[model samples]
Target chain A: MLDGFAGGFIEILQIATLMTMFVGVIAGIVASAIPGFTITMAIVLTLPLTFYMPPIQGIATMLGVYVGGLTGGMISAALLGIPGTPSAVATTFDAYPMARKGDPGRALGIGIFASFFGTLVSIIVLVLAAPPLAIVAIQLGPWEYFSLIVFAMTVIASLVGRSLVRGLIAGLIGIFLATIGPDPMMNSPRFTFDLAMLSSGLPFLAVLIGVYAVSQLLGEVEQMRSGSSKGEALIEERIVFRPLSYLMDTIRRPINLIRSSLVGVFIGAVPGAGGSIANLLAYDQARRASKDPDSFGTGVPEGVVASESGNSSTAGGGLIPMIALGIPGSAVDAVLMASLMVHGIAVGPRLMVDNPEIVYSIFVGLFIGALMMLLIALSSMRYFLMVTRIPKHIIVPIVLVFCAVGVFALNNRVTDIYLLFFVGALGYVMKKMDYPLAPLVLGVILGPIAETNLRRALSTSEDLTLFITRPVSAVLLGLAVISLVVFLRHRMRPRASADS
Target chain B: MSDPRSNNASGRPDRPEDDAAPQPEGISGDSGLLQFAFNLVMLAGFGYLFWEAMALPESRWEPLGAGTFPRVLLGALMLLNVIMLIQSAPQARAELGHGPRQLFGVAWRTMLEFRTVFTVLGAFGVFLILIRPLGFVIAAFLFAFGVQLLLGPRTWRNLVISAIIAAVATVGLQVFFAEALNVFLPRGPFS
Candidate 1:
């Protein structure tokens, strides 16, 4: 391992490799900072570009984009109250409010530091525990996956703001929305309503951009009309950059940072779940564990730290399965595996034995890439913050156009853009009614996964009791019940006290 | 075990002063009527979907079949919407106590209050419709320029700036995606 690391370090340190990695990181950051652009999209775009490079250099460059994209997502999430990627949704819960409260610099600074540390932690875990972790993850069956999703669904408890019923309704609506295109198990249509657009179903990206971005922009318009700042920028406060202090602020909550990163790593190691689930799960756990949980969504450093760290750690965690077992953890990992395959390098259990240099190069490259991302983010943060200075009237329309273009670019489908408009309107109405949107988005993401697993598990056996009999599934279900109970008890306590 | 955060969960003592305003009952006043109406529409929608799902072919191979999951979700949604309707019924009744003209007046005032949002949303809708016919650049430019003019100060300088921004964003984005990213946007006649 040491020899491999030494060899990898030398390869990555080559000026050509280092320069490409730097550019890849910048491209990743810029792509993910656009609301409709995703990390997967950025990596997919980078794939063909990397085909000409050496295997190690190509993988290293993609790794740069992976790490950079994770942190870049929080930039727009904090600045605009619109998550740049689905993974950054939890970041907006607090970071946007922090920015709105005149501390955009602090929010960005803390997020960058948290993301840096999170990558480091996940990399350490990946290096030390990859093989064993991949084996354990692969052992999980359909039952375990379904139960895990049920446990994830319990996070709606934390997101339900004032009313639990409304939150559940929103979440259920999202699940139903996911069921629109076609039934997961059988390709038979369930709710197409005979419309061509509905025939393909609502794209998750469109739902995300519409529910969050478009609704958010419309809300900004309403605020402009009502507030005194008719022609003013998003933030009028004088911005300050205090990177060192925010670093201390993030590190001071060492427990939250570590816990969130670990959550991210575990979720990323799971085959299907990725940073989108990790960010929310980490934020929920942080809130549940905090001394003052009520401050979670109110622009606290803890929320930003939890979310950014959680998502960033997934970059390292996602590489684990690909490196150890040749099983791609997510779409980005699949693209990386494809890049390696293009170089005639087989990626599987024998990968370390066959190409220890490549494995070690990846390890070292991640560390260097993370460091590069930190330097790039810190120095360029001031320019990104200039976004806050763009007047709302100008930024709103431009971003809306960007949103449309991004959605259109997703599949080059004009129908998807049309779906964005209607979804945006529904999201606006839902927002106006005080319904929490997070659970809805979460439901949409998890819905298909949950249904497919449930059906798969049942098809394997007619006995539903196997779900409880299986040790892992039982534990997961137990955890879900406990989570629901704790949330209920927490919610009821206030009303109980007021009555008393 | 008693959670430390529970004591302040509802009161949220740590919330910033600006956010400390009393939380509105989501089912009250004009908003209550809106919620009530929204729930009614949703209930009908869920009901219709549930019926549609019931007709989905049940696979003999798999026990659960295609429609089972959606049926389960739609059932839950219907139940939740019903619960929301019941909860909001009292406030909605009070709002309806006012005559039709009064209700109409309140609705008009609410619409006027959100006139800007409605206008922008309408313009966005038109932009989406025009994308295929007029192409991305032309449609996006028109939408951006028009919305900016409508929203921003409508002075001559602002109009020129809006026009410049609209042109740059639409054209620059098209070129960047096409040349750099290789994802071609719709060109319509420009194609």
Candidate 2:
């Protein structure tokens, strides 16, 4: 393992790998700093480019983008008070306020330091958590795997935003969509309805582009028509980055930094919960834990530290589940998994045994990427700040066209583009009506695994009751039921009374 | 879909100051009746799919046939849809008093409100239909220009610039994909 890791580090230091990583970092920073452009989109678009490269370079470059994008979000959050990404929503509560306080440099600087700390902490935790989890996952049977998916699905219902029913429905829709392809066991087509497109199943990349990018572009158009178009550039003044001064300021609030990062890591490790939840919850916890809770949203350094650290750390935390169990921690992790799979690397319990070199490279790559992000961000802070100058008119249509390019690029199939448009329409309607898209994607990914396991277990064993008789499976099922109950209780409560 | 941050889940700001009026689990506004109508349509679709699954021939080798898994899923979905209809009934009932004209106005207003979304979707539809016949370059150029024009800033300069941009970007991407990346993009006779 040590020898492999050492070799992995050597490979990561190669010129091609380093150059791609640098380019990825630049792209990630720029892409994510633009509001409506997500890390998932950045990673998805990056996939086609990475196909020809060696696995390590491709994965490492994406990782660089992952880390860079997490911090990149803070730029818009601070400068324009519009979070560049949903994860940066909490950052805006304080970072924007701080920037508005006439020290935009301090705002971004503090955020950068906090993000660095968060990533560092998360990497440590991921390294600690993944191996043990992987070991346990390796021991699980088909029944246990099916049960675990159920538990994950149930937990999704509770935390997946405003509507519990909508969340569940979204998940069910995903599972249904997954059922459209050939049956895992028999390879018999199930839901294709005799269409050529259905025979291959819905491509994840097209759905992702349709759901996120297309809908977001449409949303920008909607925002424009609403006459509240963010037409003018908010920052024209010279922007600066004072790393030394901000580093000192951030270090003074060690408790906030540590707590928020821990929060981020925990949330990131969960299946459905992600950076958006992490940032907000970390900020909330920081406020509650503080003596000066009253000062949370009003330009406080503590607030900025908490939110930025919380959001950034999730990158590492998200890697934990993906590396350990072959279950993607988030949509971004799903894309990362797809990238590795493109290289024909089997990702699962035996990933470590099969490919220690790749695993170790990822670990080392995380650290190196962090160092690069810090250096690149601190140096090019002003240049990135200028990216905000690009107008919405240019951005919206261009991005939509780019999304079409990405869709066509994926399979070179025009049918996929049609599917992209169809899914985009669904996404736009769902967004307008407040439906969650995550559960659908999750459902799509996990549906086949769940079904294949269930069928396998049933066929292998005589009794269907074995699922309940088995200890691990029973326990997992119990947890799933408990999650459902909790979701119900939360939904049923008269929060209206509490609000008053 | 858009945010992928916290907003991905709810399609709204995660930390809205007004905690009292929590966003509805279903579609917002005086649209419970509309939602219910949509649900009925879905229910009918699910029912048809369920019936089709029932007809799927089962093999003797596997204990659970291929249709079994999907049947289970469809059953669960059918149940959920029924439950949702029941839950939405009260709200839908309350909106029944709204006159047809009032409801029509609301629906029409919604369509107008979401004109950009529809227009963009239309552009994509046109792009998809044209891409094979006209090829990616021409289709993309037309789609890009139409989308921008509909979205506006439609001054003569913007239109000319949009046209030039549409042409350059399309050809540049095609060349990069074909030459640099060694991937084939659809080429029309003009290209």
Candidate 3:
């Protein structure tokens, strides 16, 4: 383990690797600080660019983006009172008020520090948890694996979107889309329809760029049409830098910081849940725990701490499932897994064994990324604030062009760009219809594994009853059932009360 | 625990219910009729795919055929589409009661409201088509410049700025990819 850590440090500390990571950090901050651009979009566009770099360096660069993006969101939330990303919604509750109170620098400084500590705590938990979890995960048979996927799909469907049925349908659509080209086992083409584009199957990267970047940009255009564009700065107050004082203030509420971070980690480990939920949940928890809970949204330091820490910690917590199991906890983690898979690196229980150096690099890279995020955010926040002012009209067209270029560069195939357009249109329709896109992306990633395991388990045993008779597999399936029932009840409760 | 933040110091109502309540499902008003129609289209597509899957060859070595998994998924999709169709029928009926002329007006207004989105989407389609013939640089340049002007204020200063941005993005991207990444983009006439 020590040697692995040392090797990882060596690989990541290279001048070229650090340079790209620095650039990635800047790109992430700039992208997320723009109101319409998401961290997922930033990472998705960054994917093709990383294809040219060595594996460790590429992954390291993305980690920088992930960490920087998490903190970058606080910039717009505090300065403009509009969340740059969904995860920063809670930050606006307090940080915006703080900025309004003529303490904009304090709000940003506390958030940056809280983010730094939160990442550190989550990384410690990740280091402690993932390896042992992988060891146990490696022992699971095909029955258990398939059952686990079933549970994951149900949980994801239940957690996301308003209607459980709609979420499930989106997931099913994704799995069906994955089934378009070839059958995993038989090498037989399933739904190619003799078209060359569908012959090799839809590229996952193209689907990602299309469903997220293009659709999201179109949504921004709609917002522009709706006349929500704030051409002038909302707050013109000068920011005062008092980083040391704010750092002390954030650290003074250690319990709140730690507890909120734990909430983030737990929520992030859950399939389909990510920073958006974590921030809110953590802030709620912090408010509940406070003796003077009434002060929560009134520029309280604890509020900023809890919200920023909560969202930032999810970066580490999200990595836990991706490292320990092959299953990604969220869409961002799915993209990370895709990046690794692009390098022909199989990401699963054996990942630590096959590429211990990569695992170690990840562990080290996250810590360094967090440190770098703190440094960059504290020093260059004014510039990030400037990014929030970029007009949606200009941003929309420019990003769309980037999406096209990135998708086309993925395989140097023009067909993929066409696929991106169709998928983007489909995604836009789904988004407008209120269907959540996360489960669909997860389903695409997990569909092949689910099918292969189901077949492999059945082939290994003629008795279909063994699936239920086996303890672990049965437990997983039982959990899936329970998850569905819980979601159904949760959805119906409010309507039932209203009827009464 | 009861959320104390619900009634915070900030006079702003911290209604957690806003996040908890699902946004009004699109299955209401005119959109409901559209949803019903969309569900019908999905049902047909899934049904056809299920039929196609039935013909997939089975392997003697494995109990599950190549088609089995996809068939199961398609079946679920068809079933869900049917459920959606059934759920939206009442709303669709209500929408239809508004009469064809009213419905036509609503649909026309919606198209007009989304005209910008549709226009940009159309430009994107054209760009994709042009990529093969005009090459990536020229196609991207035209698309970016055109869309920027269309979306932004139509002024001379904005036009010059948009043109410069379009050129930098296309040419700079082309050069970066070619020189640094060694990934040569399609050159077309330039090649």
The candidate scoring highest on DockQ is 1
Candidate 3 per-residue lDDT over residues B38-117, each given as its tens digit: 88988998999999999999989989989999999999999988888877676677777878887787778777778888
The top-ranked prediction according to lDDT is 1
Please provide, for model 2 over A1-500, each residue's C-alpha lDDT reduced to its tens digit, 9 standing for 90 to 100: 57866887898999999999998888788777755557887788788888999999999999999989998988867875556666886677677657656667888889998999999999888787876643454566888878866765663553245555656677787788888877888888887889887788887656655765666566666667765553433343456667799999999998889899988887787665578667866876676567765466668899899989999999888888788878887889998899999999988777878988888888888888888999999998776566445555665666666667666766777787788888888877666655666566567656877888888888788587877888988998997787677556644564656767
User: What's the lDDT for residue A297 in model 1?
Assistant: 79
Which residue pairs come into collision in candidate 1? none
- Relative to the true interface, what fraction of contacts does candidate 2 keep? 0.37
Worst 10 residues of 2 chain B by lDDT: B14-23
Better of 2 and 3 by lDDT: 3
Return the DockQ of model 2: 0.30
Model 2, C-alpha of B56: deviation from truth (Å): 3.3
Candidate 1 docking classification:
acceptable
lDDT agreement with native, every candidate: 0.87, 0.74, 0.77
RMSD to truth, every model: 3.8, 7.3, 8.2
A141-172 per-residue lDDT for model 1 (tens digits): 99999999999999878887656777788788
How far out, in Å, is residue B181 in model 2?
Answer: 3.2
Best first by TM-score, ranked: 1, 2, 3
CA displacement after TM-score superposition, residue B17 of candidate 1 (Å): 24
Give the lowest summed-lDDT range of ten residues in model 3 chain A. A227-236
